[model samples]
Target: MIREALRKLMEQAPLTREEARQVMTSIMEGQATPAQIGALLVALRMKGEAPEEVAGFAAAMREKATPVSCPEPERTVDIVGTGGDGKHTINISTLAALVVAGAGVPVAKHGNRSVSSKCGSADVLQALGVNLDLDARQLSRCLEAVGMAFLFAPKLHPAMKHAIGPRRELGVRTVFNILGPITNPAGVRRQLIGVFSRDLARLLARVLQQLGATHILLVHSDDGLDEISLAAPTYVVELKEGDIREYRIDARAFGLSPQPDGITGGDAETNAAIARRILEGEAHPAREVV
Candidate 1:
């Protein structure tokens, strides 16, 4: 099955939704060999992932994920980003999740450790003494208690274990990068997702719309940052009530100036301290970005 899929992909023929689903299911179920998995990932990337292909992969991932009950899922939102932006900016989305939760909104933050960046949400969270191994029930409780929960990807989507080695060995962005932000274990319908490529903004929005997302914002900065940029206009694809719209946003609109130099990140501990300063109401441009 994978060999045939690879051949089709090499021909630049997009997979039908069902075919992608089957391939991803097999991958998750440990049926595809590491070589096959690598080939599949590279093939899809080279072919330019179609919306149907991304939707299918996300559907299969959701089917295999360990579920966590979100408190009022319709009201809950997840803030995350595809991490291979290569900018290594401070964990903006992670900090945004905490800030949104603090503002009395229910949040289910889905994340993993650093895959392509120096520090991912889980890495920074772990640096801040937050436990990442919580089970589904415990995650639900955490959400109910503080209006926010961190859905660690490895813990919630154990099926991804099969592809971890190949994914690491390949060391390039693949379909899994797109899949992560869309496959929230808590099943929240509203989300704010940052994509590493502007081309992916509308593509991801369409994929989420096809996957039954109620409301979502897919963002990418013109300057190549995944998160909205202070340096340049950020492209936005907003999907709300089944309608998708595209727009660009600039920092000046919010009385903030472009301080691109302020956006920087180091190790987990470094980012953790930056997050703490923002949370503590320190006066910094990063605070404005967050």
Candidate 2:
């Protein structure tokens, strides 16, 4: 653990394969002090988390997190965003989960209320009256009943609770922000991930690869959305059957010819209202994209 802190403080990247596993194992064992932990976290962020570091630490999280048992792994899809969009959009990814479910795909989305944006996937979903605090059993039932279930971040990973206050106090985008999307408790093999930056989309792809993700569509919008923007082109990095591909998706593909400026929100209440429109079938562009 001390070595990780030293390496990070030196402005070097992150841990090697064995080192990451060991450090994370130590953390899970409650061996590291709070002071050591905070130092390591801040240093890693400053150095810009490396691919192996993200992969290794996330792998540790996956190991400790409560696993959800699914009868059919092949049919499950997770739709998530890294959520630094700053657009304050009305939970576009959460909205898309409904549309994706409506498309005959089984969705088990993991989300939280907005920390980086005005409304998060969980916030907008909660506004629509879908329960976000369900346990694994209730959540699984919701997925079976509605073809979608919302997995709240706090409910899934209890171990991270201690760091929550520290992360908030740091007042910057911590590694925990990116960790949410990567740590889908449902363990869905397929993922549709939206990131804020084009470069980070590609970088996240590599981490997902290490995490043993099967089929993934990683996207970034030119206009700073964590979703496929109808107003501009969306860059995509995809991994299918162990093959990685990068491409561009035009707004026209979503049937938005005039290019909508993308969904914007003022607060939870405002976004929730938009979500109501989606559920009631107002048939808007957000609806089409979702």
lDDT of 1 by residue, 97-157 (tens): 9999999999999999988889999999999999999999999999899999999999999
lDDT of each: 0.91, 0.77
Clashing pairs in 2: none
lDDT of 2: 0.77
In model 1, the Cα lDDT at residue 107 comes to 94
For model 2, how does the per-residue alpha-carbon lDDT over 22-73 read when each residue is reduced to its tens digit? 6766666667766666777788777887778788878877777766655456
